[model samples]
Target chain A: MNRMILYKEWLKTRWFLLAAFLVLAAGTFYMGLSLSKTVQFNGADKLWEVLVSKETVLLETLKYLPLAVGGLLAVVQFFPETARKRLKLTLHLPYPQGRMMAMMYGYGLAALTILFLLQATVLTVSLRHYFVTELVVRIMVTAAVWYLAGYAAYIWVAAVCLEPTWRMRVVVIVLLAALVRLLFLSGVPESYNGILPWLVLYVLCGQVLIFHSVARFKEGLQD
Target chain B: MKKIGKIFIGLSLALLVLWLVPWVYRIVTLESYSTPFTLYSCVVHDFTSLDRSDARNFRFIDRKGNVYGDEVQPLFYHSILASKGAFPDSLEGIPVTEEMVEHNSVILSAEPKEFNVKKAPVYLLMESVPVRLELHDPEDAFVVRKNGLAVYRMADNTLLEEKTGRFNAALSAEGFRFPANLVAGKPSHHKEYDEGYLLTDAEGKLFHLKQVDGEPVVRHFPAADSLDLRQILITEFTNRATLGYLVDRDNRLHMLRPDGTVIPTEVRYDPAREDLLVVGDLFYYTVKTSDADGEHFFALRSDDFSLVDRMDRPYDFEEEVNLCKYVFPCRLSFTSSDDGWVKPRFSDFSWIGLVVDLLVAVFIIAWRWRRKNTNN
Candidate 1:
């Protein structure tokens, strides 16, 4: 039954996952090309000096890409189910409803994790070619928060889609906007070093909100 | 499951309310005010400041509330006063010249955000004894590791094994340990000269490292070993009176001389939490340090570092009472004026605001009850 649920989620989001991967690959490729050009025009010494002295990681393009992919993937996977009222039938399947929902969310989470890891690996490989290990690690630590923001975006969008009432959906959206703002308050590299663990906890606890929306749907509640 | 979800949602909403309500209140009641720029005047033998409260015309006032027009300009604005041919021929029986004022005057500022940042552990060691008497950036950079220093040629990112071995041997001979605790230097060719880097080893022993004539010049200063050093700042002031400033664990400021002597100054400065400004002339050094509470001014004689005068200006509290404490139980901020790191900080909790919070809750409940009755 879990395989069937996972397969259904894959069938719904296969194209989107492919597009996200391609978009991420193109971004990484562009970053690599730009870095190579900089090293070619001005010697590697100047490039290293800029990286050490400046507050930039040269990965600003990837900042919002993960967030966009996560939000869009949630919409692609769940919007049709809610819009066509097919979620009610899915809830009535032979499997336990809680397990069913968990499997669906787990599949999405797994796919996103795999995609984000690939992106991180590409960044590490490319950055290491021109920078030392310490500098490369600094960039990775700075980019960690953006990837976490992606997961939070996915979960919040899922919660909004599953909500039965329009008023509550709007409320969830406002709260999600505020919450996402917290993840991007500072542009200084590694500024989130201290609060990253608590932010991860917040994202994990937020998974329960989707269950609340589904529970409302089960109660035959609608606006 | 529904109950748990509702509780989480309530908690998230409460966090937002606590963080954002006070933020909005402060923004709405924001006022524009700046601290006056105060400097000690040798002529008046007291502190003088420009009163800018009246934007149309600024008045120069002494500490004793005596206002002066334009005649006192030569005391502070020596260059401009000299250009106007109103320069003093002699003051306090010492002859004054524009060249002397230009050379002796120095301004040093230190802010918390500048020091409270994480930086990459790579340093550019400029050549101190350049071929043409002008400092030039070196082709190699060094990183201190647990074993020793490793020099990498920035052009190809390859190790300079011979140079690294030479410097490592010199450091070992001087009893320097690996894994430095703090490395401070002015790493720019724009400076008058290069002083290389001042480093504290793993055991907090201070060592001065510089490159002269393409070789290493390492000096160990054992006088600082007894002091628990927290930070060191290298200065290349035009006067060349001192090498740098050393901050000890007790928040005391010390002047480091090129001859390996450290003299304690009479200024109270905490580099981690305060902003420091030092304005020096030929005779006296006026140091200003500001923190959350207020600003402190210290005047020290330039020759012996003795305290001449001191003053304090506390921040105004009446400006903070404009509905902030009454509306916000606590303020939440991610960025701070004291540091550059972005982390959550909840401060200034007001028990009075809890009464307002309760009233808001009662109002919300009453409105909800009325709405339910109307629907019925």
Candidate 2:
């Protein structure tokens, strides 16, 4: 209900903001260097061509970093500190558990958005040298799917860590990996090259699973 | 009390089955079974042992004999040889070009938004196995089994060795049995570069066939060193059998083995003799040539590192050419030569049909689930 509270807290988390910025910076540098080289060699001067080319190079490098770091950070980012503090703070928060959970997810998603936008900007810059077309549209679709998947991963880790038992977390992660492999194996024969669909399906399923955390949240620093 | 419980249970079960349709449909109607024809492919190598990757393609034939088509994927060598990701298209983007559509002589009328025609078509069924190249001829393309021996049609409808074994055993193991109505023909009119053979049934169902030279006793080998036995060769090797070879565009050699192992060799090929020679790039094979007075040894360069010469005969051995060229390579080079045959192992599209069946089951289940939900 109070979305602004979540957004404000996300802005207040200095470490999280810094991490997001670093990811964007690294992504931009990688794209800039790659684009310069591509222009020198291929002469891809159209805005669309440059955008697709540079953005692809940039986002590909930045894609996995967010998922991995975001997942780990979810455990600590806004997690209540002590058992007493959790009751006094998270439990006594000014919103229903659903809205609070939504805020956490919102923050994670915001971080991912920033990273993708930076990567997309670099891609657009590269495309400007090439041509003006719907290259940005293609890049947006690809980057959005990737960032959403990463955000889901972050939320999943944060919620799992809130629950007690590291062993259970490990078990859940392994199970999730196995399910993804099954989906891939099932989809492959139908697809000519099955990997893309597998990737897309994993992100979709991950996002779905992340929503479950929101549906079943408890205000506790420890189980 | 018992009567009421039974009535409630029966109604719930009926409703539960109705809610499962869409999921069933999604699985059942996958791309594999969307088309009517079974696709068969092989790679055609150039004079050099390296395959012309772009030259990779497939052979398709319908069960009714009404349709046949050839789909050519892009060149294989460009990506590997260039060591650049700048390959024309990703394996998914490999297209059914005008050339491919024209090659099979199948009419092209429909264009859809789903597929990327310029790029992004499925090339190899498995990336490791190069997409099968349709040998040059359309109608002359044939794959058949005779007296338990696998046979393929060469240029001009000439029967050539393809594979051998108890056909029933291999087909059943591969989850494919011979089709009921068998038809036979070359894939296309051009046989100039195509040294392999093909076989089809009356219903247009197809299989790879070839004959081995030695004894009536059948021999079996693994199809590839990497994959499990189920995927190697289709079935157990039985007596009265022959061996089969597929020269892929990447110069990767696929040989069907007994006990169902598909052995992929890094050998070179001589298409004229339909033999696989293990000669490397720096090495050469010596074939004997006959002059008017005497026979002289001729040296043929083996630059591409192929397992077999693309022909049945050695390139320099035969004088008159044509069929003799088919025999020369078989006699010379590499290990003691077995009478080698080549056939296109048609993709087991039966999986797609299974998917469709599963979709129907899901649809029924979904409908029943929704009905129960509504009742509750």
Candidate 3:
């Protein structure tokens, strides 16, 4: 049953996920190419100066792409089921409905995690070829927040989509926007180091709000 | 289980309200505010002001609204009193020489933006004894391990064991402990000359360490005890008359003279919270520490480092519009100035906001309950 559910989740999100992967890979490659060109034009020593002494992480293009991908993932996965009332039938299936719902989320999250990790690894490995350890660490730390922004957007979008009623959805949208805004407030390298733990907790806890959506859909509460 | 989900939704809404209420109130109440560019004039022993918007148009006005500058500009330079006057022949009662202005005028600034930014904990210990101060590029950076035990050169990512031993031995012989707490220096090549890093070891003892000709030159400043030192500022003054400012735990400012003597001065600064800017001229060193409240200006004698005058002003924003006091008595904020991280900060709270939130929650629940019964 879990296999079937996972397959259904993949079947629903494969096209969108492929496009997301391509967009992310292209963005990462552009960041690498741009950085290599800078080193080529300015020399490796000057590139070291800007990275170590100054605050240009050279990866600003990757900032909001992950966010859009996350949002679109949630909408694509669940909106069809909700519109066709297929989700209602799934809820009535002969299984613990919670497990079935979680299986669907689990598959989507696994795909996203792999996509984001690959994006990070490619950028970091390429950065290390020219930059030394200290410079590479700073660049990766600065870029980490944007990747986390993707995760936060993904869960928040799920919370919005799962919600059954218009009144609650409106409130969820406002809250999600504010919550995501926190991820991009500061661009200073390593600035996110301390709050990152709490941010992870917030994102995880925010994901729990989707359970509220599931409960509402089961209760058939609509405005 | 379903009730837990409902509670979570309520909690999320409450958190959003906590952040948004104060921000919205601030947006509605925020005003455009400007304060005069204030400087402490040594002649009058009070704060002198120039309109921040119009530097040329503003007269040197005293706290008493007594306007003076036409005569003073000439004294500093016959040209400013003339038009192109650079340095005056004399000040109120003392002779003003071109040499004094050249040596005395220096500026230093400290803000959260500077210290709050994450440091790599790597420094280039340039050869301080060299006649020419050639700065090091980022490629030559090195990390000084706990108590100078090891110095790892970042260029080749190699440890210089023998050199590190000799440097650490010199420091260890001079009552230094292992693992330095604060190592302060300006390693950028853009400076006129490099001043060696000032480090306080684990025991809080101060030592001066710099790399010279591939050898570590360790000098100890016998002036300060380590336990009380809060932060170090290396001014690298051109005249080399003063080393920099040392902030004590009490936030009292002290002038570090070249002879390794710490001269306690009345530059009241909150080393942790406030941003400080020290501007030195021939006559006085104006130390300004600005914060959310406003700005505090302190003028010290350029030669003697005495408190000549002081002035304090509160920004009109806090004074003019304060609806948070009435509406959001207690608020939740996720950002802070004291540190670089953004986390949950609950501050300036009044119970009124909490009570209102409770009312909203009740209304939400009651409204939903009524709708369910009507549908049934």
Highest lDDT among the candidates is held by which one? 1
Worst 10 residues of 1 chain A by lDDT: A45-54
Off by over 4 Å in 1: B53-59, B69-76, B322-324, B355-376
- For B1-376, candidate 1 gives per-residue lDDT tens digits of 9999998988888888778877887788888756888887777778878877654554668888998643454545886677777888877679988788778787889899878887778887678889999877667788877888988888777888999999888888888999888999877888788889999999999999999887888999988888899888887788888888899999888888888888898787899989999998888888999998899999888777788999999987565664667876777877887776887788888888878988998999999999999999
lDDT of 2 at A193: 27
The superposed Cα distance between candidate 3 and the true structure at residue B113, in angstroms, equals 3.3
Task: Give the alpha carbon lDDT tens digit for every residue of A148-179 in model 3.
Answer: 77777777778778788998888878877887
Clashes in each model (backbone N, CA, C under 3 Å)? 0, 140, 16
lDDT of 3 by residue, B57-100 (tens): 65777788788764533323334544545455567677866666
Ranking by DockQ: 1, 3, 2
As a whole number from 0 to 100, the lDDT of residue B358 in candidate 1 is 83
Candidate topping TM-score: 1
Error of 3 at A215 (Å): 2.6
Candidate numbers sorted by TM-score from highest down = 1, 3, 2
* Docking class for candidate 3: acceptable
Candidate 3's TM-score: 0.87
**Best-performing candidate as measured by DockQ:** 1
Cα lDDT tens digits for candidate 2, A1-223: 4656665565546576677677667776786677567656654332222232231323455555655656655654645422234523553666775566556666766766666566667667654443322333444444444454455566556545443445544644654443322222211112222234544554444443333333323322233
